[model samples]
Target: MQHTDKSLQRKVNFLLYYAVISTSIFLVFILSSFVGKDKNLTADEITVKRITVVGEDNLPRMVLSNETRQHSGRMEGKEFPKRERPAGIIFFTNKGDECGGIVAATTAKDGSVNHGMSFTMDNYHDDQVIQLLNDETYENGKAEVSRGLMFNEYPVGSNLNDRMAKTEELKKIADPKEREAKIGELWDKEGAKRRMFIGRNVNADAGVFLYDAKGKPKMKIYVDKAGNPKIEVRDSTGKYKNIIQQ
Candidate 1:
């Protein structure tokens, strides 16, 4: 009976041990789950090279980065290789395509200044269609400033990859005449031109300029530095048909 008592006591101890281990394990799992569910990280100041905001599918939607660490842009699910860019945030579409963002900064060195900013929004699968831009450049002892709103054209159904391929093909052309002809055919498209410009031109004229689909100037209403206001209109052939000055 003493031996029996000992055996039963050993069984009880074993059961107690099992129960303790199982309870500890369950409690640890519950605590870890609560810890994992905590998604917020609060801090007063955080410094990093880049911060990427992702969507539910774990794809980056926006990235704030320094110039060196900026995200290489994407097009139609393909990412371009890394390139030098100004420090800024890069906006991406939901499907991971690059849409647009602010890429503006100023750099001055050795008596030369390149100061400007371009706030641009791009087309669905193409380049910038509209922008607010400011450019100030002082190089080789000459200074120029251009600030304005501009609208560009992107041919419907044009693809960035197609343009890139065209550029590559142009590079392989051996004949200058043939290359120029190819350029005219490739670049001179109905919807691939600067359609409107409203700002200070390089010639220091502050005004609005409209262009046709072929990028020929169709109209201009601007004022010179001396405050002379002028309006000019062109016919279908882009010849000046009327000019009014005040």
Candidate 2:
């Protein structure tokens, strides 16, 4: 009888152990299912100061924000020396450079408002080989705002960084006159040339102005707001020869 009782007790203990193990496993699986469940979020409104979109390698490709939050077009770890621009979207190249952007601003001090959208292509390691732009600027109490589509070409330099460094060095000059001369020299080295303009001028005239490499308007197809049209022919030196009116 003692032997039989001992065997029965051993069987009961084994059954209890099995029940505990199974119960533990079942509880673990239930907890895991809850943890893996999807969570959905809903919101009525969300506001942010600025948003930066990152590329595959986690580098910034684009940014959207207000003036204070506007990106300064910093690229390749080099910062361009400039002030805060108005609110707009700034785009970055795949190589993390400032390719182009759309910006607008209103200033009380200048009593002016302006907006511009532009796209640029890089050449010789510097931007401004070709530019497509739509820009407008209005001054307080002005008769008409200046708005236009412009194609521009900035003279290329051997090195952008070197030229920028030279500019910074020039800024350190103590004499204002000397600094001004140096500034002119800098511009002469990399002056921007307007190749074409097709839009309304500030004088309320709509026209197409074709320019020469020296930034001279060589030919013009002009039309006033009054519907008067004229074609002006110019010489190689941009001297006007004849005007055909319609």
Candidate 3:
């Protein structure tokens, strides 16, 4: 009877040990499931709270509390520091995929926005007007503006004098009927096409003019608010072709 009692107690101990081990395994699986659920946080979702600007002759300055930089992942602002003559008024914007706009204000000796021109660049192809001064005082400044076009080189067309000379030469060679036909063919071959103009803006308030080989005005483009020139074209019948903005 004592031997039987020892065997039953052994079975009870074995069952208790198995119960504890099973409970531990179940608890571990439950805990792992709770920790592994998706939290839904990404790197792009994090915001940049501040931006640090660095420039010449100045310590690094941090501009805080700007929400514009947070959304676009960049920062831009203006700083006017009191210093000696010919000091530059620097405008800065931080780096990102689509960075913020730049507000470059060039000041004269009196610290005013020089000649009412603000230099800026919004995109890659936009024309940026940069002032060329004789000295740092910004005296005797000249304005030069440029427009961007697609082609690498500008095409050539007939000049007014050359067209007139061609007409005269054709009259001498053929009858009026044949001369008119030849002139039409020449116009179709050379006169109907347009030329491309590409250049960078050198100064503000400067206008870029596009002319045909005949020295006639083809288009007049001006700089926009973002410091980029807007090109306006017209058809022969005076209808608008399209506005090209850089």
In candidate 1, stretches whose alpha carbon ends up further than 4 angstroms from where it belongs are: 1-38, 108-111, 180-184, 235-242
lDDT of each: 0.84, 0.73, 0.44
State the lDDT of candidate 1 residue by residue for 48-104, as single tens digits: 999999887777799998888988888887888888888888888888888888887
lDDT value, candidate 2, whole model: 0.73
Cα lDDT, model 2, residue 72: 73
TM-score of 3: 0.19
lDDT of 3 by residue, 15-126 (tens): 9999999999999987776666563335655455445555443433323324333222222222223233221222333332222132223455743224332223322221
* Maximum-lDDT candidate: 1
Candidates sorted on lDDT, descending: 1, 2, 3
- Higher-lDDT candidate of 1 and 2: 1
* Cα lDDT of model 2 by residue, 100-183, tens digit: 776665444467766566555545445565555556665765544556667767664545666777888999999999998998
The alpha-carbon deviation from the true structure for residue 193 of candidate 1, after best TM-score superposition, in angstroms, is 0.8
RMSD of each: 6.5, 9.0, 21.9
Backbone steric clashes in candidate 2, count: 0
lDDT of 3 at 242: 41
